[model samples]
Target: MSDPATNPPPAEGEERTSDASSTDETVAVVQAQEDEPNFTPITKDFGFLPIPKHLRHDPKHPAYFGLLLNATFGFAGTFVLANLYYCQPLLIQFSHTFNVSYDTVSRIPTLVQVGYAVGLLLISTLGDLVRRRPLIIMLVFICASLSIGLSFTTNFAVFQALCFLIGVFTVVPQILLPLAADLAPPERRATALSIVLSGLLLGILLARVLAGVIAQFVSWRVVYYLAFSVQYVVCVWLYLVLPDYPAKNKGATYFGLLWGMAKFAVTEPQLVQAVLISIPSAACYTNFWVTLTFLLGGPPYNYSTLVIGLFGLVGMVGVGLAPPLGRLIDSLVPWFASVIACVAYILTHVIMVGADGINVAAVVIVCIGIDVFRQMVQVSLTTAVFSLDPAARSRMNAIILISLFIGQIMGTAVGSEVYTQHGWRPAAALNLAWSGLMLFVVLARGPHVSRYTWVGWEGGLEVRKSKVTAQKRRDEEAGASDIQQRGDEKHALEAKQSVREEKDLQDATTVGMQEVKISETSEGEKQGEDQPPMVEVATLSAE
Candidate 1:
């Protein structure tokens, strides 16, 4: 190519030179600017927003930030939920201690579930209205008191009632979950959420194990006392350290706040889908753990409560794998990885259904598989819901969580019935069926993007833009219609004023004309009368 920059060589070459010249000059300007300490654009005036000194975050200790949140909020909140289940391993012992039937003692856990469901809705809604930190502190103390009361109670009715109340306050875990996600940077959000959720699973598993050990050695009542003590200490620590954000539902009335969340949910389809998909999945996972203990304790292996509790130790493998899976979530396409994780969950159920005898190796492997899948899917679902609306994340969480609670209830009922009617194999088989159905739904429906998309996950910011093509056309038509309506109103007002002015001018003109005519006629009559009287007087003198 001839150097066309020096001279416009040919017609085609001239066009090429014109296009390339601006690009070359812009590159030169950028290079020149790089040499200077700070350079201004000098083109269309644009300035960067000022960076605040205090707003900056330290990136080095990202994991440490989440660990602090988990230790304070996760540890205490889960301790309460864990305590609800501490009665699980000791339910038989508790029934004997109180001289109650196994059926009557089972109501304790059911009461806790009802209380938990109510608490999640009540405390979460209030937390949306007020500061979360204070409520979390209060909830923990109240729950601790209930646990203490449960420890001292000899009365079955009173104990069951307090157990329900403990469930009501156990929602501190729900509050902690969203807070962890809020506190974490974008890349770390899934990891942070997973870590906190792992605490939830850990509490469920360890509560049984710890209770079994305590009941075996000390006494079942001592388990509640120990949990109550831990909760009180954690309540104090969390009140001191947990960060508070501005209320999500500020200035909204009780009914109005709930209605607003409902409105947003109906308008947003992705939220609806995420919650729907989570229901079956959560049900299956919860049923697996609850039923597993009962099966192991009853069968040919006939394990003790402590031996059954040790099975939960294998769940540590699932928690350990969370960070790696969270990292992979970023690397892979979301729906693809989600589908894979769901498959793992479905397969684990297959392994569990086939488990018989002591089968220690098979059971551990199955539990690990199930836990890993549970953590991964949960992380993905949270990502999807939070991705939909950054501003309304708390409410979105509340809506999805209601489904999880409902799922828990269903799971508990199914596990109890299946174990009683059809043995461990059939019960585990039913869980597998639940997982398979959920997997099929996920694959068939696929991942969805909303009309509104969020950006800046790391910094927790959202910039709304119109995505649907018809939106611009609709906006233009609305603007034009508004202008036309205003114009028509202005013209109608002007026409009415013009008619009034015309009528007033006509009345004034008519009055002036009548006065002039009257004056002229009077002058003419006086002249005529004077002339005739003068003529008559002259004729009389002549006579």
Candidate 2:
């Protein structure tokens, strides 16, 4: 048979055929392009603005490039958020240079964090309302410029307001986190979140220490100058590497984004659960460190301020433990891991209560253990919220960060007062109480398991198992129906054969009776051969 596809074209010079000829030519060109073996199209829109490719993903099919780039962006988040914390250690330097009281200088860190809370409510909402890549770029540029302006300001009030602006602009980490979670494959989403969180943790741990050391060598103003330079560098790098992730709530107004977040907090049980866990967790973490600095600075140890900053190194174990523990959530129920974290917090605080009463080694070990567990819980809970509203991940993240910073700010305020009034032991007791509250929250927020939702199994596996079992049940029913139909056919065939056998038997019996009659008549004729009335006798017998 001739192939229609390969057949020769007809003559194309007809008067009315020019339009058809042109259409055929266009289709042929398109088909040829499609058939070319090595042509791959670029679908991502990075040139104009970010429109995130919410590409459908399977747990089994992984993309290594996406994973690696996600990590790179996560690393960038560390430097971006570090701008918020660089002012913390410089407070002492600021007080000495400006001839201000300690209480007056403390307002710097407070204002910055308060500004961060405000920014969480305002600027981070833009991640949901505008393109995240360009939004990040614009925010960081503003931060870098402000940091430079801050270094030149001699007036205390101006400097304090600049710190606030710095806080407001250094929310790039908040935006980066949700985007990373969205870009990650379904199975690796938790791990990706953990890695990004580790960046945040790294920035938190090092920011104060790096600033204190830098101020030790150079002037405190230089630290802000350096921050300005770092932010500029980060802005350029983000422009090159960070592709656009489109806004989820594209049509929402500024006020609407804020309203949506408030509504979620009120109506979403999961968001409330996340807040409960985060409050105690952040309170314990911040209260411990801030109080520990006081204890180590004043007690039998009598450590220096720089030495107090060095204690952040003990929590470096968290930077390593974060991702593995996040993967642990991939296997176990997240609530179970959170419960473990809360219990760890309680026990560590208990141990610290007695040990801080004694010596330093025991306290250091307890701090490390608590830091590790706290980071794990953070990763678990954040991953959970990211899933709660995939469409509103950035806004969900804004809520988490706002809760966390508020907890930290409150913890520091209350913890510093307690440390000044009572001592380290009483503050330890207070933290212990907080840990117990966290444990209760975890229990209350635990997931309810249905029959298909067996504990300690991946959710994807459970769904696949349900589908397989349903298909098997369908197959079994179909097989049973086929067996029933075959049995009915067999019974019908048996009934037909029985009817034919009965008729054949009746026919044979009739033939045998006819043969017997003929034989008997022949014998009678022989016996009455001489009799003339044989025919009349036979006729009478027949009658």
lDDT of 1 by residue, 190-290 (tens): 66676677778778877978888888888799999898899898876765566544344446777776787788767765566566667877788778777
Which digits, one per residue and each the tens of the lDDT, describe model 2 over residues 1-543? 121123332333322122211222112222443466764433334456443342211122212225456666667777777877888888778998888999999888878888888888888878777767677888888988998888898898888888888888888888888777765544455677777888888887777778888899999888888878988898777766665443465457888888888898777766777788798788888888888877888858898876777888887888887767766765555666677777887888889888975788977887797788788778778866675666677788899887887778778888888878999888888788888898887665435333232223232323232243355567877999999989889988888888889889999999999999999999998877766676887999999
TM-score of each: 0.67, 0.72
Where is model 2 more than 4 Å wrong at Cα? 1-67, 449-543
Predicted structure 1, TM vs. truth: 0.67
Worst 10 residues of 1 by lDDT: 455-464
lDDT of each: 0.68, 0.72
**Top TM-score: which candidate number?**
2
- Which residue pairs clash within candidate 2? 50-244
| Candidate closest to the true structure, highest lDDT | 2
